[model samples]
Every structure is written in C-alpha cells, then in structure tokens.
Target: MYKLQLKPADKMPKYKQIVQSFIADIERGVLKDGAQLPTITELSGEYDLARDTVEKAYRELRERGFLTSVQGKGYYVQAHGDTKLKILLVFNKLSSYKKLIYYAFIEALGDQATVDLQIHHYNAHLFQEIIERSLGKYNYYVVMPHFTLATSQEEYLKVLELIPAEELVLLDKDIPELNRQVPGVFQDFNRDIGGALDALAKELERYPRMTMILPSDDNYPVEIDRGFRQFCRYNDKQVAVKDNATDEVLTPGTAYVVVRETDLVELVKKVRQTSYLLGREIGIITFNETPLKELLNMTVITTDFEQMGRTAAQLILEKKRIKVKNPFYTIRRGSL
Candidate 1:
C-alpha cells in the first residue's frame, strides 16, 4: 500500500503527480533501496491511467535516480533527487519595486535556488534583439512590459509569442489582449490608486485641488488616471483631467499627476515655469518613480519598483504552486 493519491484537478500534469508520489515515498523511507516497484503496465492498470502516463512517471523517476530500470526487469526504488529551480527577472528600470522585488526574491528563494535579473530599457527593437540573444540562459523569465505604447508598438507581445508561454510571468502590465497565452502577476493600478488616494487624503490641508496630467496616448498611464479620477469623483471632489491632444486643461490647481515624465516633460516644465512666474508652488506626482522625479521636490505617489522586480522573480519561481489565474500586488510609496 503506497498510499499515494493523485488529483486530476491539480494544474501540474498527471505524470508529474505520479512521479512526485514515488519521490515522496522514497524520501519517507517507505520505498527502500533496491525495492522492486510495479512495472509501468501494472501501475497503469492499477491506477486506471494511461500507459504513457505511468511510463512517463517511471521515466522521470529513473532520470532523477529515484528509480532504476533494467531492460527486461521491473523498476526499483533508489534515492530522492534534487529539485533546484532558477529564475530570471527582466525589467526596464531598477526602481523601487524592482529593487524590492530583487531582494525579496533572493530572500524567499534562499540558497536552494538562483535568481538572475536583466535590466532592459523600454525599447521595442532592443527587446526583440534581446529575445533572440538570450535563448536558453535561464529556466524562466519574469518580464515587465513597460514599453511606451505611444510608439504604437507591440514588440513585447511578439517576444511573448516567440517565447514559450509557460516560461514567462508578466509583472506590472498585462499582455493578455495580445493573446500570448502567458500567466501574469499584475500590478493592480486600481488597488494602488486607492492606497495612493488614502495617503493623499492625509495631506488634505497641504493641497487644495488635485489634477491628473495623463499621457495623451499610453494605456498604463491612462488607466492610472482613470482610477485616480474615479477615486476623486467617489469622494465628491471635482475630477480635473487633461484631454488627449488638447492643451486646454494644463491650468494649475494644487497637484499635477503624470504617468511618464518623458511624454509630458515640456508640460511639467511649463507648469513649473508658470508657477515660478506666478510665485505659486504646485505639487507633482508621476509613475515609474525614476531618478529624475526624485531630483525635484514633487510629492510622489509611486510603486516600490525594486520590490516589484524581486517579487516578480519570487512569483515566477513559485508560480506552479499558485492557485489563482491572475494574481496582482500593489505597493504604495510617498504622496502627492
């Protein structure tokens, strides 16, 4: 009586289940060295599973040295095998979420597994090149698709299609619409906005009116603006947003929120200039939390980009054990 059970509902394949069961028995000392194990056909019949499934289980056990098979003889138990794992964290920036994710990933993985991170900027053509260059350097990729959609490019989506779907764990963005068929760990903008708003509310006396300056043509920034506007509207605060391709809404209030500084630098600079011209101070907040934003005294509502990187690595390594289809995490830092 091996007492091993398999559940078909589990996401891991049936063969892997059978293989793990044998390994567990071996590790528990129930299956001793040189103990004659049932033949693949016999196990197949007993479990009412396909013969190929049973053979795959035995083959994996043999490959891992947990079992030995002689050409004409039945399988025999041997030893437990090492189950080391490896992961790769790929991101556009080495920001807070990225740093936090890196450290947390290393800590969570501990000494058993190794994690390697690659910093890739938001360049579609460069990403396409990197995809071809790093064909088999690691077991899995934790990708952050931070390419500026303003370029009307989906190179990352193409890269996703080129890579094995199961080998990727997308973070901070979604490519599901691309139909790449990969799993994801989303950075919940809605949840993040709620947290940022709560933090902003604490500074109610410091700022009077809040206005969002969104990128005229970016999905991520647009989503954040929508969430922020919804939050303000929910609280009965007047929602002031910059219309796409329109310069009519750049008027000063109290706060100016942006997604990407690169897209709206001129506008931000203009606002600052106008403020200086009028001798008034305006608070600013932007996404991605880059060093340029830090150089200024703008109140920031940002994600922990470093932690995001590290956690992306952790999630990819632990992906097999996750029960949820689309898991998300949001971390709040500073205020505006």
Candidate 2:
C-alpha cells in the first residue's frame, strides 16, 4: 500500500499533504509510472479521512498533470510526475534583501517545484524579451515587476497578458499600470512606511529634522515616496528627500531615513568619520531588516521578506488565487 504521510501537527491542509506525499513518492520511484492510486473509498475508510478530502487530492493530482484517470480502471501515475511543475522567477534585481525573499521561497517549496531565476536588471525591454522566449515552458510565472523604464503600464500588461492568469504570481511591488486579477504576495508601501513612521514618531521627536535618502534606481518602490511625504505632512515635521546618492553628509541634529543598503553604508561611513553618534546625535532608519542591521542595533521599517516569499510559495502549492499583504512593522533598535 502507498502510505500518505499526513501529520496532524503539520499546518498544511490534509488534502495537500496527501497530494504532496504522492508527488514525493513518485519522485522517489516508490510509485512507478502507470501505478494505480488507492480509491477514494479505500483511503477514506482505512485512514479515517473524509471521502471529499481523498477525492480533492486525487482531483488536484489530475489537474496538476501528475495523474491520469481511466474510464474503467483507477487513477494511474503520469510518468512518475517528473514533468509536473516548473516555476520561473522573474526579478528586477537580486539585492541582499531580495535574496532573503528568494531563499525563503525556494526553501519553502522543497522538491515540489523546479525554479528558474532570471534577472531583468530593471530593464523593461529585457524583461519582456525573457518572458517572450520562455512562454509555454513553465507551469507558473512569478514576476517582480519593478522597471525603471518609461514603458507604459499597457506595455507591461501586453507582455504579461500572454501568460494565463492561473499561472501568474506577482511579487514585491505592484505595477500600478498592470492591475490584473493575478494572485501574489505584495507589500503595501504606503501603509507599511506610514505605519512604521507613526510607531517611531516618538523617537523621531528627538531629531528636529528628518531626511529621506531615495535613489534614482527603480529597485525602490515609488509608493514609498508618497508614504514618506504623507507621514511628514501628517506629523508637520521638517523633512527632506536626498535624491542624490553623492549627498551622504551625516547631520548631527537631523535623522536620516535611507532605503538602499549602499546609502546606509555611506551614512555609517560618515558616522565613523566624525564624532556623531547613532540613535542620538544622528538618527538612522533603514529599510528592510537584516542580520547585520539588527546586530548594529539599527532601527528599521520594513515588511517581512521571509513571509513574502513563503506566502508566494504557498499560493503556488495550493493553486490559490489570493493577494496576501505581507506583515509590516518596525524593529525599534538604538539607531532610531
């Protein structure tokens, strides 16, 4: 008998656990090609599972191209499920923070998916070309659409329209232009940054002036700009946007809100150059939490990148179509 490894302690649904067990067994060659799966009645009665649960697993197995149902005979394995699922990870760029999202995504999937990572380098043309050549080759298309080009929303949509909605998963920032019905795990930059700043407003009261360091690159979300401005207006505080990367002077009485790690390094360098102290003389707020940032006792306002990737993976595994807003918060360390 083929045993379905279903653990009550596991958070995954029972039907998915059953489906994953069959896929794992097929990969391990325990369930050979053309091997018959136990009937719903048999699994239900023997394993104390509901008939609907077993049926749902078998139904998904067939839908995912892992099994074939014969008219008279039972469901048979389809070529051991070796060609079942392949995913494409279309990212704008692989930064230190995004690597966390990527690793968490791959780790959560385990052997359930084969992923191909492609870097678009914030080029819309190249992003389109990569998608064009890889069409019909993957089971799912996971895209991080953060392009710096003047490419219209229609252009991105035109390219993405080629992929079926069932196989599309948007990640990170949402293209305000291509608001399709695709499911994904995304960050609400406006709400995220606004709320984080609100939580740190008391700490921010120490510094009379707050400056935001925004890079010209498309890697950072545009919504963040709107959020920062909104927060400043609401709080009626003195704030400045340092759009140029070359401007890295650490003001003693002013706090700096930096986005990119490169800018953070520059500010830290300035901090070391002079006697300006962090969290007190020079307040520092960086985006995205990292191991090193925490060790430095730096405050950060960011979303959970691990949850972003894991939720995206879960969407693919369960074939669910839902937009999940990743949890956002602040880690109030000494930097703030």
Candidate 3:
C-alpha cells in the first residue's frame, strides 16, 4: 500500500504534495514496476482529496513515464528512470499569462526529465545581480530581458556578455549586439501588431479617422508603430504620430493609442476625464493590454505570456536532446 500523505499546514500546494509523495513512493520501490495503482476515484475516496488533485498527480506521473494507464482500467507504475535536468526561469513582473506559461512549461518538461527548477524575479538592480550569480548555479539560463526606459541597453549588454549564449535562452525582448552563443525565443511583435491592426481596421469601418496613441520609450512602442503603419498603408489610412497627448492632433476619426509605461496611463486618464479628448469619435487600441484598455473599452493586442514561458522552457529542453537551436516567437491575441 502507498502512503498517500497530505499536509494541511505546508505552504506547498496540495497538488504538488501529491506529486512529491508519488515520486518518493516510486523511487523507494515500495510501488514495484508495473504495479497497478488505485483509480483516481478510489484514491480520492481513500485520501479524502478532490478528484482533480489525484488526476493532476497521475497525469504528471504519466507525462514523466513513471506510470501508464490501460484502457478501461487504472494506472500502473512504470520502470524507474533517470531524473530530469535543472533549468532556471527568469522573468520581470509576473503576470497572468506569464503564470500560465510557467505552468505549461512544467507540464511539457515532464517530471522524469526535469529534476530541478528555479524561478528568479528580476526587479531593478536585482535582475543584474541574479544574472551574475546564476552563471555557475544553473545548467540552463532562460532569460526574459524586459527593459524599461530606465534600464540602459549597454548595461544589459554587459550582463549578457557574461553568459555563454549557447546555454542562455532569451524570452520576449531582444538584446542588440548579442553574441551568437545565446539562444533566444523572442516575442514576435511584428506579426502581432499586424494582426491587431487588421482587427482594428475591421472596427474602424464603423468608426473612421483612426488615430493611434502609442506611449513611447526605448523603441518598445516603435515596433508596434511599424505594424500599425504597415497595416494602415495596406488599407490606405494615414497616421498622425506624436510622443505625448499635448501634441496629439486628433481629428474626426478613430484614434489608435500606443503608450509607454511612462505617463501613458496618466495621459489616457486625462484624455478620458477631459471632455475635449473624449469628445472625438476616436477608436482606441493599445499595444500592450492594461487597465486602461478594459476601463476605456479599447481594443488590445497582447502576448500569450504563459505560452511564451512554456515554449521557452520546451525550447531549452529540446535543445538538450537535438543540440539544435529551437526558434521562439509570440502569439497575438486581440480583444476589446
């Protein structure tokens, strides 16, 4: 019999507890190879756990090849195998999509193949410090280079120079003049902005005179501008560009708003609150989704953060097997 234990007070999540217990049991050989285990329903009844908990744990074990299920039957233990490798997940400012990506990544890595993992949050000077310390601690370094206007690209490049590019994985943004050794799975905004524009164009037919209000800083808003311009050219629309709202030349048309993290939101709040700004029949769209998008009821082009994380992790693991660079890109989701 397997000792299915549950700790109510532990900070570790319940599903993870079930996973750790199952792995320990398998390694101890108490659960012999090809041994038939209890059905999820049976386990749930025995342990007083929800069925979802048991199912998730079993699915994890199956992904790692620790167990296999027979049709119309229960799961059985598979032969013990070598443990998984260690991989580090580094990011700045965790979001919903990013969390999703991390979960999916763990799923794809499989329990057997991934023995260890570390998550480091990059905040201000902490990002640089973590990168410097990570060189020797982790076998694989997956980085999300999310630079704000305050972060100097030169300073960032100095840190990038330290990691062997081959062992490093870049997620979301790109580092210019990067050495070839770094393998990057970057977020593709070109396609995303194009798609957002297409969606906006369809919306624009109802609301003419489209105006794009993009917040600017460190070329982040520029790529989105390129896409919006490309689509506008494709559809025969003219764009009036400006760095801030004070210079905004809003005519009778739908306004496409692009903003940077700096002062973009405040500008929008001013525009919304001020009767003069909101009086125009302007259709709005943002490059990155924000509270303003939801509050103002504007269209949004966003990156599938969780998917990006998962794919980056998968690419890193895949690189280990094939020794070939697995490409990275972004998924564009358009919404109101």
- Tens digit of per-residue lDDT, candidate 3, span 1-336: 566756677687777888776666566444678889888988888888899988888898899888999998878989675334556677665655566667777777777344233344444367677765554434566777766656666777777677766567777766557755456656556666676567555555654455555546433535666776777777777666666665554444545555553444554555666454342454455555556556655456666655665666667766742222223222222321
**For each candidate, how many residue pairs have backbone atoms clashing (under 3 Å)?**
19, 0, 25
**Local distance difference test, each candidate:** 0.62, 0.83, 0.62
Per residue, candidate 1 scores C-alpha lDDT tens digits across 1-336 of 454557666788999988877775565355667888987777778788899988888888888888887778878888654344556667777755567667876786777666667776777777677765554444567777787655454556777676666767777776556664666656667667766766666553355566676655444445676688777776666667764313534444465566656534655566655533211345565665556656654455666555554555556656652312223332233334
Candidate 2 stretches with Cα past 4 Å from truth are 1-83, 175-179
In terms of lDDT, the best-performing candidate is 2
Please provide, for model 2 over 216-244, each residue's C-alpha lDDT reduced to its tens digit, 9 standing for 90 to 100: 65556678888998988888878788775
lDDT value for candidate 2? 0.83
- For residue 293, model 2's alpha carbon misses the true position, in angstroms, by 1.8
Off by over 4 Å in 1: 1-84, 178-181, 198-208, 213-220, 232-253, 258-300, 304-310, 321-336
What local lDDT score does residue 153 receive in model 2, on the 0 to 100 scale?
A: 70
List candidate 3 stretches off by more than 4 Å: 1-82, 110-125, 150-152, 199-202, 205-208, 216-221, 233-236, 241-252, 258-281, 286-298, 320-336
> Residue 284's C-alpha lDDT in candidate 3?
52
328 Cα displacement, candidate 3 (Å): 12
Task: Name the 10 consecutive residues with the lowest summed lDDT in model 2.
Answer: 172-181
- TM-score of each predicted structure versus truth: 0.52, 0.73, 0.54
Question: Best to worst by lDDT, what's the order?
Answer: 2, 1, 3
